[model samples]
Target: MTSKRVFIYAGGEIDPISIKSIKQDDYIIGADRGALFLVDNGIKPHISVGDFDSVNAEEFARIQGFSDEILSCDAVNKDLTDTELAFDIAIEQQPTEIIMVGVSGSRLDHTLGNIHMLLRGLEQQISCFIWDRNNYITLTDSTHIVEDRGYTYASLLALSPEVTGINLEGFLYPLENATLKMGQSLGVSNRLVEAKGTIHIASGLLLVIQSKD
Candidate 1:
């Protein structure tokens, strides 16, 4: 069986054309101004979720006109960010992959928050990834494989204090049952030697960053 993918748009900046080629079989959700961003780019999100405070009346009205469903949250008294709310909704659908968009912007706090939100999906065994024009980030624990995407570089960083028993194969810089510390930069700027690559970890969380020039 094929896995289902969900594309979620947060209020961060994004280039719609980056994902313009994505097929119509996936689900789409917009958060706050993200909904306006989608509609402005002629991309119709299946539903929009978030507090209406971020977007102005004109943009909110515009979203309401075209979006299938608009879930408005209270701005002042809310526990979750718009993107988190969107993730909560996406989780309900039992998706296999969650592609987060418009989540990496100037706001450092929100960007970090969105990254940690992957843990929520992680617990549910959903393969959540953060994608932008130049970056692809995914969180992994234990063993994982990364195909040689024919890209420029791939990096692995420790999400927890330390990731032990780390192993890397088919990469420019390979590791063999090694341990990586959280603040270490040893796993940065790795290249692939073959068509596919593999990453294996025994404990702790790891963040894989695949990028191209």
Candidate 2:
């Protein structure tokens, strides 16, 4: 049976955590060269997406054999990025949660674009996360209970121009009805004092990042 969770892997910097998060029941999608990664790792993806311009004929053929479904488009004619195309497919299933992996890398534009894609989850009321070896990231517009998942630091940032009435509980540096403005580094490197911390925001979007060196 298909699970309520969807995991989309894109061509980028991958870490063990991203691969390790896969479970037997997960609906896995490989975008472009990401399919090669999955197939090489001995896992067949449910769907393979993108124009796959990054792969050679042999690799593409291997991905075709390994994937149950394929969604392809012309690389030059397509408007969406390969990762966004994979995300579009994932959103169609209306899963309870969507996890994006291998979307962050040396390319600053791609990384930031992927991060911005999390806003779609907030708009659709679906939980979304970007997972990497050293960082786990999500966005919220309201109250949220953040559990410490063995990460050493938790940070909050205002995704909008400003986030108002922010309150943090069980954090080493607690805030009370404070405001956070974008372009400020005041919220960086906070630690969870308790096993679970609470972040409440009255208005605007906030990005929560849990990371470790």
Candidate 3:
């Protein structure tokens, strides 16, 4: 039997807990300085894809030696970000799921952009998640059952214009057929009340953020 291929994108400032959660069967993909983080943690990337802009010349050379495959991009001109490029390579491998780590710490704009890339994988029916020190973020359009074993606080945000007919079960603060609008904080900081929780939405896109303090 073939083992599932899990891809990890090491950005910067990877949480030790998060690193521990990463399985050995997973394949690592590094994005710029993210490559350095992976090497620092004694992980050799199966494939490294990024522009060397954020990586120093000496560090980039060292990372290239560690990577099985290296794809370099232009520092000046580029359409896709390094994270997106790494995602493309991971998709080519057709992994069971892609769990991105260290993609969310420093830059808010980069974090948001990486989150948006999850939608691309959604279209391909591949589960993708962005994980950092505090949170795991994913996009969902339909009903999702989240087992309470892994996460502490759960939040559902409207990614589209509006999310209607939102229902929550087994949550500290329950909602029935509620409409969650973009930029609304009402859905934030919800706790799971049972061993499992269910979030159902009749329409529109939703971003689920499962976090720990």
Scored by lDDT, the top model is: 2
Per-residue CA lDDT of model 1 for 1-213, tens digit only, reads 488989898878675765675568888899988888888888888999999788889889999998989899899899998998999999997999999998988999998899898888888999998877677788999777887655688999999999999999899899998888999999998988888889999999999988887
For residues 1-213, could you state the per-residue lDDT of candidate 2 as single tens digits? 334899998888777556776888788999998889999998789999999999999999999998999898998997999999999899998888999988998899999999999999889887899988888899999998889899999999989999999999999999999999999888999999999999999999999999999
Quote the positional error of residue 174 for candidate 3 in Å: 1.5
lDDT of 3 by residue, 83-194 (tens): 8888888888777678888778778898888888888888877778887777878888888877764778999888898999999999999999999999999999999989
TM-score of each: 0.92, 0.95, 0.89
The stretch of ten residues in a row with the least summed lDDT in candidate 1 is: 14-23
Candidate 2 ranges with C-alpha deviation above 4 Å? 1-3
* Model 2 poorest ten-residue lDDT run: 13-22
Order of candidate numbers by lDDT, starting with the best: 2, 1, 3
Candidate 3's displacement at residue 183, Å, is 2.3
Q: What lDDT does the true structure give each of the candidates?
A: 0.87, 0.91, 0.82
Model 2 whole-model lDDT (C-alpha atoms):
0.91
Which one wins on TM-score? 2
